[model samples]
Target: MSRRDAEDLEAAPDLIAEGARVLSGADIEGARFEAKIILAHILATKPSRVVINADPLAPDSISRFRELVSKRASRVPLQYVIGTHDFMGLMLACRPGVFVPRPETEVLVETVLGSLRPGRDRPTVADVGCGSGAIAVAIAHHLPGAAVHAVDISADAVRLTAENARRLGLAQSVRVYEGHLLDPLLAAGVADELDAIVANLPYIPSGEIDGLAPEISKHEPREALDGGPDGLMYFRKLVSQIEALPPRRRLVALEVGLGQARQVARLLQSGLECSAIEMRRDHGGIERIVLGFIDSQSH
Candidate 1:
């Protein structure tokens, strides 16, 4: 075949079509879009430009693209493969063994941001179990005067979160520590100073972790899921810790799994003696975010 004919066979559309077919066979949704995105990554070009530029992949590039497609076909999370995830309009570094930020958690962030008191400027906030620094960085980025801390049990997650904060020029604004839940903050004596605390803890029931999507059960970190028997184990633990806070009006936001919001809210209300609680639904209409406010007088 002529070189031009070879180019036609190796064009972006042809590659994406072939990839999409393979991905679809693997039961991946949005196969075409994923294929395009993978191709765009290999080509170091935008997805729209993949075809607009109509450039054929180099032989080595083709091999690399196929390798990534195979990894995805095996159910590896796309964010891990791409090395980044979009959260709150910011691209955060992601890696295997770290929790990927979900779109639903954006609602949790919005609620926290909105719930901030009018005159309480420069509030200190802690993002417990802050995987990839999504919540911590988003809060710091949006609320400039706020002090943010991101903590995680996994060293990999801590590193990724710190990297993201630095990459987004929030290294100074968002402090990251390696510890389980809020332990690091407590050690640093920042626990009582925290005006707000947000956590997207592992809420998937232990028995249900293996039943989740292959991308989650097989690829994502188990510590980032697996919430013991009733899926409220970590929430209970965090609430217990919050009880040590000094008397003050504090805002706490938590992202819970399916059908787990109400239980988590109750845990907050009773455990923290929260004066009021609010549940916010995600795009799916599931009550995914539970916010609790403990008034100073409640102490």
Candidate 2:
């Protein structure tokens, strides 16, 4: 019998653990969970159940598990294989082409909530380039009273964001619009009225995208990752548009690439400067968030 066939005779739990050990040694975090998920899928059982029973997997299940291990070993992002990721403590539905929401983006949400907290009133918020609706849905869930608007340049992103909003029960409050940057909201004449505008826009330069990890370079959409030349294309456009708005009590937050915080902050001209900009550090101590607020002087 093949190795897969042998597994059908109640493959030993220790054997599965062996596979997990190999993957772990290869620097794959959550090895057991990965192993369990693949095994469970092949067995047609829940991952949780796979843990409780410790039952040997069948031949087909073992074969499938090995294939997943090979893929994971190739440095494929775990989220891509699992088809979902936990962001802001929520399970967001993810897909191959959609930009995978990074954990550091949570700072953008927190910054918005912190600023809005003092007012203690419902505010209209916009998440430009709302890939996967991670930022928009998280805000809506955190502040149930807020009206959230999300827009993405990519149609695929718009569809994914809409689906995620619906899945998270924030569809009513989080409106997903398909358009570039602020176009959708401006078309609706709601740009100037926003209390907060947040985004995790593409900051990777067009040429640099090819150097990104395969999980991003090979799998994610170019329009969602490429930020044109110098990686400041979108920021320049966003800053210019935001500055034109008649000064209102508006806060703008963006997730910037490494070492781009200072440059991004500088783009906030029209009296908006670093003082008005708050820098947030990510888990890796990189300056990740550039938050600027509209003040009376800017008007």
Deviation in angstroms for 112 in model 1? 0.9
For model 1, how does the per-residue alpha-carbon lDDT over 1-299 read when each residue is reduced to its tens digit? 67866775566347788889989999999998998888888777777877833655566677788899988999998888777788989988888989999999899999888888476678899999988889999999998989998899989888988999899999888999999788899899888888899999999899988888999999999999989998889998998888876788888899999998888888888888888899999999999999998898763
Report the lDDT of model 1 for residue 120.
Answer: 67
For model 2, the superposed segments whose C-alpha errors exceed 4 Å read 1-9, 12-53, 58-64, 71-75, 270-275, 296-299
How high is the lDDT of residue 145 in model 2? 91
The C-alpha lDDT values of all candidates are: 0.87, 0.80
Off by over 4 Å in 1: 1-13
- Per-model TM against the reference: 0.94, 0.86
